[model samples]
Target: MLSTAGRHIISGEHGLFRDQVRKFLAKEALPHLDRWEADGIVDRSFWLACGGAGLLCPSVPEALGGPGLDFSFNAIVAEELAYIGCNAGITLQSDIVCGYIEAFGSEAMQQAWLPSMLSGETITAIAMTEPGTGSDLKAMGTTVRREGDDYVISGAKTYITNGQNADIVIVVAATASEQGRKGLSLILVEATRPGFARGRNLDKIGQHAADTSELFFDEVRVPVSNRLGEEGKGFPCLMAQLPQERLSIAISAQASAQRAFDEALAFTKGRRTFGQPVFDFQNSRFVLAGLASRLQVGWAHLDWAIARHVAGELTAAEASAAKLFHTELLWECCDKALQLHGGAGYMNEYPIARLWRDARVTRIYGGTSEIMLEIIGRSL
Candidate 1:
């Protein structure tokens, strides 16, 4: 655990909540993580357990059967999950999908979905990335057209999180082709709909436990009421949620980096080389010193961002910058820590190997590091 003074933004209750989360994860998630990774999907039972513990969808209000907490609670779960290297797509559900539905979905939609979601009886995925689209939302090829009282959605989305297990998918498709970004709309499609299909789970280099797959909609139809917000407001709705989504990614990256460093420190101390503990070497100590300094700065900045986020003052640009910096820092720390473990780190038997593998994808998702710089530069 981080030995520094606790985060200023996390209250005593939040700490207690964090402890509750750790205990729940220890009992429910850690034991099955390797099997999930091997299977390329987390079991449905685990989601149910999280729901039973009230660990899913922390920010949804009591009316929706949620704990009625805040984003800090979501961040706590993400941090703990990352520290233990458990990637089960819960953060995507809690931090990203729940926010979109709670903030924009119609009353009937909310009532229909939120309760089961909070109970972990329902799994959700947001379909944004497509075959030919990356970083540019305007390049999307999916289309939704009205036919009487129903809207037919047709397109395929790749790199979708929770694709295999999702009971519902929030699909982003063009409602009007001529309006560019303004034409996009968020349409809720049940996975059991007539033409909806899930492709094979793609083999990934990291986060193997999270089921990432390709989803297809071929004339899949839903009632007009299933549309989120207004017909052409999907772009704005997506933009509003980007800050929290990126912040969630940043929080996970920072925690994972801390875990990698801790693993390296422990390994070095216990390891012997040339009649001395590896940590006794000046080189090892200096490398760890540098990492420690960086982690200290990272924790302080993370707290500042979390505070601003809770106050509704965090900007998309600021969130982008945080994602950029923290994910890069994660890669740097994991790489160096793996090096500190020498040959042992390269072996899958060591936790450092998994840490190193998992650290690479944070820079790519939640807006790539390159996209983050562009967003920040545009703001300046």
Candidate 2:
């Protein structure tokens, strides 16, 4: 009844871990949703609490302040957060950004950053997607050039999640613009740097509690030690890491869609119209039936993708396909669920309204559906 009933490929440890996360969110996070949404960000206290509960950076090795757990724990975190419609800012830090540092950073670099991240003493953001660049890394205008023992970075990054509160930002910049993507480099910039500035805590249509923003690096300088990997390997690193990122997105997409479905099913079964339950109506029945069918199939596919990812067999194209299918499915499920709510769905009071709004960006961010198709089509 919760959706994905048969689809969880969990061992005993994972099941216990999932329960712990579920309980933690319910007690520490869910109750404060309204206030956080109004403030446009979750409180830092909650992040600290999450870290205390062993919820952050589960996959990062213990030597680097992580629990050294598998990726399944990360997926569990992503799934549980989306299931409750909690803004996914935490998952972004743990699943996507942490993976980059863990996979590519030097030992000294990892030791410097990963501990604070694991403790939730620090917040992190990845600065890609500049104002004009969209998803094209080659067109990015951000530049990082060597100056003595430091690298000077100058550019703007927009649509950055966790931007308003990020203590550390992994910046994608061009070290040599003439080489196209070959010139790209990922620079680590502390938010307290002299020229690093955040533009605004962006007001968005939904997921208001998630702090998305614009960041500026106006000749920000950091030691050469701040670079994540090789000076010019940023694009390749991004490409390599994107499969996990996309899979993380797919997990949230599938979970949210299922949540929306559950909400609609409950509403249609209980709400009455014309002296009959809404579920008794033929149109409502058909709508729900179709959604249920799709959700079942979606869960199975999600499980398969998760399994492949666990085995290190999941390819970039497969992750793209998962992302494309699940995000589109999320949008559809939210839309139909909202429609079934009649008038209340449009009101902010209804969960469906926020779910609908939150689902919009899943298709846009993490590479748009068109970009996903392009990636997949190239392999055919």
Candidate 3:
């Protein structure tokens, strides 16, 4: 049954990859997720294990010590991870941050980072959403001033995924004197560098196992060679890369929705109310039927988006649409699923509670639903 669902959602090499990733997650990740959530961060050993499993940065080319798989393979991993309810931050690290480096980094930078990243010896994070600026990349306060082959960076980034555990961070900062989008640039900052300090591992409402942090850079100097793409080209780089990031979030949302639906279905069937199982109630059946229909649509849309992404045809608006729709649907699914679970859903001991908590941020991060609609509306 799992294989059939896997085949429907993915294909060929990606299907095989999904199977391997699923097996790895079941064996290595699932059991530890609750413990990791309690600890507020996953152990670095798991990253190394995933690297050894060849599950990190599958889209990266073999020259960089990756599997060289396509975006479909990446989607496969995302789907499987979400299916197992693993931390979303880990997926963000292995899939999204690595893509930025692979796409924008120079040959020397790639060679230096890719091997370690692929080996799980190095973890990466993208520091963009600042304490003051959330999605407004142009209004970023982080400044990286040029000083003889090095850029002195001073700023603070909040809500950074993998922030505490990240060995490499791709920082977006303002280099141009002018405001709005043009002045921004992306720089690769090593975590070990002087003046690079990580603040507290933030307490969050959800996804506790995934490390979200606040990072501070005070006079942090990085060589000019660490600049990604070109100086003052960071805005374009960020725009170009956003489709994938949004798509990754959408994929996870879809999988999460499906998981919540499945759990709800099982719960409604097994749970007893008044005098009969909850599934016996017309309201429960109708709610689940509607959610199932939405899930089907969500899956179809996501699959189409994944195909476009694999062909390099996915547009920012389209990706945003997927992110917005699927994530919103995921919230509905979680809410209704929790509702169906009665009071049990509100308790942490139940999986639905965790699912409920985790689903809230889907709408907020990776560009809020409002931001997504604005992007799509502008395109139209």
Taking the tens digit of each residue's C-alpha lDDT, what string does model 1 give over 1-380?
A: 64436668878898788889999999998899889989999999999999999889999988876788888889898999899999999999999999999999988999999999998999999999999997888878999999999999999999999999999999999999788789999999999999999999999998899999999999999999999999999999999999999999999999999999999999999999999999999999999999989998999999899889988999999999999999999999999999999999999999989999988989998899999999999999
State the C-alpha lDDT per candidate. Answer: 0.93, 0.91, 0.88
**Estimated TM-score per prediction?**
0.98, 0.98, 0.97
| Model 3 ranges off by over 4 Å | 1-9
TM-score sort, best first: 1, 2, 3
Question: Which segments of candidate 2 are over 4 A away from where they belong?
Answer: 1-4
- Residue 286 C-alpha lDDT in model 3: 98
Candidate 3 lDDT by residue in tens digits, 1-380: 13235336455766567678888888999889889989999999999998899888888887787777787877877888887678846667766788788889999999999899888899999999988899878889999899999899999999999999999999999998486688889999999999999999999999999999999999999999999998999999988888999999998898888889998999999999898999999999999999989987888788889889988999999999999999999999999999999988888988889988998999999999999999999999
Better of 2 and 3 by lDDT: 2
Scored by lDDT, the top model is 1
Model 3 residue 126 lDDT? 92
TM accuracy, model 3 = 0.97
C-alpha RMSD for every candidate: 1.0, 1.1, 1.4
